[model samples]
Target: MGPIGGKSKLKEAAVGFALGAVGGCILGATEDPVDKIVSVMTTSGSLKPVMDEVRAVGALGLGTLIGATALTTAMTSVIAGVILAAVVASMFVAMRSCTGSHEHSVGLWASAGFAGAIGTTLSGASFGIVVELIVKNYGMVGLLWALSFFTVLKPPLRFVFKVLWKQGEICCTPGSEVRSREREHIEITDWQQRQRVTLQIEQRILSLEKGGSTSGIEGRTMWATQQKEREELERRKLENEEAEMAQRSIQDWINTVMVKHVDFLAFSGIPMAIVAIVTSGFGLFGYGGHQSVFLVLLALVGLLGYFLLKSSDFKFWMLVGCMGMFAIFVIGMLTLHAGQVVVTTAVKMRAAGRNLSREQISTAMNYQSSLEAVKTAFFGAKLCQLGLGATVGGALVRRSAGDVKVIAGAASVAGSLLAGLEVLAPALGDGGTAGALLGVVGATGVSVGATAATAGRWSSWPGTLGTIGGLLIGALGMGKWHIVNIGLQLPVAYVFAMINPF
Candidate 1:
């Protein structure tokens, strides 16, 4: 035999190869998005179908690519942080003998944060150039093929890491091994003490059995107390052991699923996917003259989401629904205002004896709030910025002492400042990049806040309510003045990124 695990490795490879072949075949069979758009528009003689196809492709392809890029940016930022820490440590080594002196380590965190920000910014810029090059050369089909390949490779890679490579076994962070060893020692000592107590109790029971009627009333009472104490200790010990096992299992599962498979595109794509699905449902039902049926189906979905969602905490869903309702209200008001502005401007022009066309009025209403803006949001530069902001927000959450609310507040403030910078510059928000980036930051904050609120045994309803309330306040206040068009879909990605779907 080659090795004990050779057969399993071979089987894994075989499965991967089969899946990859199937995925490749499926991807290869699909037409390019551009080709599909051209064909659909030519046949239909309408922009509606073309826009729908574009939305589907944008969400599926560009969203995935942006997510992948964000992941790459996060990795780069981590590497940058490590390098900066090492440099700072070396500097401290020259100043102090121990190299880890508390006084000398004051700038370590600052240096790491600075390096991470700079590194991610540069990475984002480079990603834009790379994306432009890829599109120039391979087109959208390439993105499809790339995503398919990743999907196909994911399972085998997971198995290799979890099983063959045993990466999951080495789960401790720096200095955690020592703590783990200490815990084990304490547990061993406790077990030994329990055994001694058990032996003493058994001896006492034997003595009582041998001399049953000779004991006084006080002695029998003492024995009864001892028996109760022994039972309580054993019960407590068993509970502790069970709790430890459960904690370990939960942590392991989180590591395997959420940490390992952090896909931003999927996170961001979920909202887009939902929108697409709902829109498609409407179109299909309306086309077949079953508009009422579509409404019924939507209501059913709402009911299921309200009552039967077992995948995630129910409180989270409620918070998301509230946030969504607020967003819808904001969108409705904006649309109504935009319509008024368009009409008012058109009338003024007509009164001045210069009648404007419908196209001209529509153009004045701002393209940044349209589907075109959604398409533009996924532009390489903008997507990279949004991803970087989200990564930074998530890092802030990690650095806190599990106080997600404070970190989220800090992140939102930072994002607002970034968006404000665009306002001062004016060139940045002209493209809606500022809005998109700020949206991701705000979304990340809420996602982290929601996680902290509902993750533990007792739900922090106040925290959950506060986070949602803050989101609405920020959306209404900042969105109108600085970051226009902060959509609801992108936050879905941020939320899913933090919350484990499984």
Candidate 2:
């Protein structure tokens, strides 16, 4: 044959080769020999009719391609080929459906597309199964020929259904409008009005009978009962009014305290920053494996500095409480040094003879069984610290709000204790000890401070300072066994770098 002539024609040859290759692969990989043979024979015979139907449905371009390749066949039929074709076709249908009017009406284009794709794909598989069964009984060549003819007719059948569904006219009744109109026009307005009137008259008569019965009651007893009800309602109303007034007063007090505290912080920004730098620097440079302590202390110092600037508005005892919390933080840091020493010694003893992995060494030193435990302890401690900071800061800011200050103070103390427990519980395995101490300290301080602060009398600065000093000494006595360096290196460095910029 010439290059452009006979079976070697450019378009026909390419399409024929492709179809033949696909068919061959499908046949060779088919599950059953009989089914494969029959399927090919049926497809071959059905090609022409299928193409004709496809063309009639205005899919001539696609139909031509399918027609040209319809006769191509393979040695065997593969289940995969049928599955692949069905899936692709179903997906194409689903995409079309999504873009069509059905999806737009329901406002679920994506969901409909997904659902439709699955449904169609499954339907296609079912059709494939039917084709497989038919092909098993027939010959391969015959099935192939039949499928080619079937392709031409299938499109038209599918198109008819699509059109019918889109129009919603497939099973609808014709010329039913007259009946619908008659049904819509039917009315019983007069009867409904009469029924409503009858119900109203019945209700009125019942109410009159009840009233007449009540009027027959002894007048003195009825009068006393009415008076009692009136008094009760009046008392309840007064109580409600008093409660509302009290709540309003409390809210007003809180607002006033908040405004004063916020203003104080704003005014004392410079001094607060200085205090933060000093405290944070000391903690950072002096402590080993406790870098976070510096940051926490710095924040507290900054907050206190702000309070001092607005000392005129702050209650004396609130200042004392703030200072006391800071002292406790320092004490905790000092205590942690002893924990570190114990941890180091334990690790050393465990690894005395045998070679140990880095992970093992770390676990032994920390007295933690797993990395997960360490992570949990660290996270819990951080949460407790944050809670403590918030509580103390809120109390200082709202000290003038009576019992709120006490509550905040108590919460801060509890949070600190929880943080302590987070650290010690894992190492010591002691239950309730840490929690009990926290409750005792929190309750005592909160109750005392709340009572005094709510009394609306300010304590002297000397008295406030003395109380804080005493608390600091006590905490230090408890925690001073841990000796770690405490210095102001980081803050100093930061300040120097900022000023010099070198």
Instruction: Flag regions of model 2 displaced more than 4 Å.
Output: 1-217, 272-421, 424-502
Model 2, 111-135: lDDT tens digits are: 3222322332233223334443443
**Candidate 1 has which clashing residue pairs, if any?**
267-493, 268-493
As a TM-score, model 2 comes out at 0.23
lDDT of candidate model 1 versus the reference: 0.37
Would you list the C-alpha lDDT of every candidate in the order shown?
0.37, 0.32
Question: For residues 173-224, what per-residue lDDT tens digits would candidate 1 score against the true structure?
Answer: 3223433454566577667767866886687788889985445786688668
Query: lDDT for model 2, on a 0 to 1 scale?
Result: 0.32
Pick by TM-score: which candidate is best? Answer: 1
